[model samples]
Target: MIKAQGLRKTFTTRSRKGTQTVEAVRGVDLQVGKGEIFGVLGPNGAGKTTTIRMLATLIAPDAGQAVIADHDLLKEPAAVRRKLGYVSQAGGVEDIMSARAQIMMAARIHGVADPKRAADDVLKRFDLTEMADRPGRTLSGGQKRRVSIALGLVHDPPLLFLDEPTTGLDPQNRANLWDRIKQLRESGTSVLLSTHYLDEADVLCDRLVIVDHGQIVAEGTPAELKRGVSGDVITLRVDGLETAAETLKPFAREIRVDEDVLRVYVDDGEHTLPALLRTLEERGIRLSSIALDRCTLDDVFLAHTGRSLRDTGADA
Candidate 1:
């Protein structure tokens, strides 16, 4: 379980334009319930990782208050570390270290009663027993990732912090990791996952917060956030954008103009599409394309941020 308020972090970076102050996390408020998979969903530079790092005690927040697993974040960092497992985006593997060796070292660091038993148990759990003796460089991407997670779990902590855990894995590997994460929740381990993948967040998180520009724009269950969009989406590509938007206004709850698309939100898209088409015809609007789709998390994002998550480069 985790709770934090107004957590902030900033950095100075030197670019061609010279040194500039960057507020990676302006002020983020987060909460994760016990036995649940909570997600921080956002774009690449949206500060999800910065927030997670703060909560995991890997980085100190510029200003905020937090309690991770009942330990004060600022005052009891060591205690917090003992209560949580942190698997960073890097996969935390050494090229020369064997999977079994890495896990045993982790167990030993955590002071497990039996290091070999702990390592062996995790290797078997993650199905890495076959490659347990192989060095990290010899393992496949999926195997290396699974071994990283196994290392995190060797100590059997109650909470886990996963930062972009599946960023580079293939679909099969991502699915495998997802199943394992879901199992962790079922087994009563709380997880805080930071990801830019919409499908991953939608499928894995019990509740999630959407962040953009270093701020949380929305927070709710996936279904709840999608429901907040309040209607189906009808996307259209017409020659006369503004005129088409005006003509379709009465029939639409809202309209968002993208570069080549006009997304019209309406409660009755099927019925309204005909009227919209008729109105467009009367207005002499040349319709290039049209489509109807159920509202999605992306739509929710568009409503709150005036930009699609896809457009924001959240996809892998």
Candidate 2:
């Protein structure tokens, strides 16, 4: 229920030398189908949060156009705001208010006639009912995060923008929140979430767009993206890059050697392993460990962006 075309945002700041402009988002094109859970994956400072802010009507784009829930973001931002529920990267709820109070207050501000019922419904569905009376300031980080989620969802808007929805929670709490997000989508809420966790995006998103340097580097289902990498990955713990590189040259489709390991990409690791072992044995290259597995999102990212998400230095 969301579409953005040629979206761009730039920020200007004064430096000691002169003013410099930073392009946070550049010509980004995004589409989220109705009732679909779409994910934006990137490392910190990749403009994921900036894109979300622009979509949520919290920030205006420097260029391009967007239609959120059939309302133009630039032309009819008020309507867009009415249709979207935003959970920002920074916390949104009050510290001292209880979860129930926070949600109820949000509903009232959003013009919901029955704030109590709205608050109760969200609390029950999000599994915050037992903790409704607990003060947000006194709650655990996960609980406070849940309260923020509840506040966003209290109005039951058709479109939701969640930035790092499960960033700081424990595994169990993260799983619990995932179930609730799934339920929201099943009930026909369109969600667009931005996250750094590849495993979370793999499990929770129907499709994803990978962003880097404020631009989309790749977009696909997790499986499709993984399969785009052309071979199996073999991790070999062999000392001496020069020796391993020489020994592995004939058997590997591509060879990348670090200080004490050689990563080989090949069409057939199972068959290639024997040849690789024979070459290593013939050359007397000592091997400590060998592992073969299919490529992952990290590999796909490296292929596209020449950098891992973990290495991207994104602060957000």
Candidate 3:
């Protein structure tokens, strides 16, 4: 149970001997229902982390009203901290300490009555029992990430904040972490996760808010966001894309030509692809590749932001 209204945070920095203020998070309104996994999706420098820091009570917001599990964040920060757990991008682990020892120290700091028992339990749950005695620095990247998660959950807080939980992990490790996050939600832990991984949000989030330039641009379930596009997407890569594009103009609801790839938006991709292929063949265009699929969150983003997620540019 977390809620925020008109949440904003700003910071001042010196650049080239000149001072400038950056509005990291501006008027962010977020609500996380009990036991729900709410996701914050944004690219780098999009204020997702800034909003999370404010919600965790680690940083004060410039203007906002926030409540965490019945405690006002601005008025009762200590009470809010007792009810929430935070796992940062840096993985929050001491390199020299063993997993069990590290978690035990965290439990003790949180004033858990049975710190030893709690540490043992979390180590086992996160599959770190075998390496519980090993120093954190000796653990593999995946292992260290899991240990960080275990530390965050050691206190058994009802609400959890995970900022880029699987940032640099391999695919296998990423999936493993996703499973653990899902299990937490199933066990009634309200999770607020910020991730740039589109597929991760598509698979794990129940509801998501897309943030850009320190503001929420869109909010919906994955299906709702995809459906916002209102059609199938047919992608064709052919030599002489400009000529093929001119020929396919009559059939296209919306056409975008990027390099040699021609992206056509239509009501039915199955029907559109055949006609598109026929037109290309008639025009003697050399087809390189063709891919047809339903719309995705990336498409939704491209539609709203006028740029692909993977576009290479200084702004992206």
Candidate 4:
């Protein structure tokens, strides 16, 4: 439902250091299939939002071409807008307006045949009926978020752009939103979600692209991406990190030492741990702790970017 090629955007900002031009997006390309939940995964400032804005026609790309629901982004922005729904991080709902009022207003603006019915349907679909009469300011963060999503669906668009849709919600609400998003896909709405949360992408996306420094470093299904980094991860807190790393080097496929922790990637963590412990003991190496875990999306991110997602500052 969406295709983008060579998308790029740059922003100029002034700081005490002086004016600097930041390349928010650089030649990013995307292809989202119909009825698929595609994710653009990245840290803040990694160009995920900029790429979404360009594809959604909310902002023009500096250099790129895109088509959403068969409408050219640059040549037919209005038509693109008609086929797509956008729920930004900071929802645009008015604080004073009740959930029902806001949804109704959106339906009316979208020229829905029956604004009230459409609004009510979406409110029910998003499970916001109980809070429909509550003012946006009076609702909880999760409630307001649901209302925002309802507003986006009021027009019955075929595609949706959700930029960090669950950034601030608690775990319960995040999971709830995930279910709603899954329903959208089942109902044949193509969703392009941009989020920094690894677990979100793993659980919610059919396919995803990892962006860093304004470029895509990797792209695939959650399982496919996790497979890119082989083996279970073994973390050992030892007294002599360097010696421990050398001792395990022969058995490990990959090794990373951070502070006092020696992390090794091995084909079989459970099988190797016992032998590794015996070897360490024979070498008189004292281990404070040891852990074995399956490779996760976070591990994939670290392999691609050399940093954890949480370490990437919220602003970036």
Instruction: List the candidates' TM-scores in order.
Output: 0.95, 0.92, 0.92, 0.95
Estimate, for each residue in 186-279, the C-alpha lDDT of model 2 and write its tens digit: 9999999999887788889999999988999999988888877746888888767787887677777777754466778888888888888888
Q: lDDT, candidate 1, residue 33?
A: 94
Candidate 2 stretches with Cα past 4 Å from truth are 15-17, 246-250, 257-260, 313-316
Worst window of 10 by summed lDDT in candidate 2: 307-316
- TM-score of model number 4: 0.95
Q: Candidate 3: TM-score?
A: 0.92
Per-residue accuracy of model 3 over 190-303 as CA lDDT, tens digit each: 999998888988999999998888999889998898877757888888888788888888887778876558888888888777877888888898988889888877777777
Q: What are the per-model numbers of colliding residue pairs? A: 0, 2, 0, 1
**Tens digits of per-residue lDDT for model 1 on 1-316?**
8889999999999999999999999889988999999999998999988898888888999999999899999999999999999899998999998999999999999989999999998888888899999989999888888998998999999999899999889999999999999999998999999998989999999999999989999999999998788668999999978878888889877888987899999997888878888888888889899999888888888899888899887793
- lDDT per residue for candidate 4 within 1-316, as digits (tens), equals 9888999999999999999999999899899999999999988889988888888788899998988899999999999999999999997878998999999999988889999999889988988888899878998888888888888999999999999999888899888889999999999999999998888998999999999999999999999987778678898899889988998898788888754577788878899889998999999999899999987777788788777676786422
Q: Against the true structure, what is every candidate's RMSD?
A: 1.6, 2.3, 2.4, 1.8
Instruction: State the C-alpha lDDT per candidate.
Output: 0.91, 0.85, 0.88, 0.88
- Which should have the higher lDDT, number 1 or number 3? 1
| Cα deviation of 123, candidate 4, in Å | 1.0
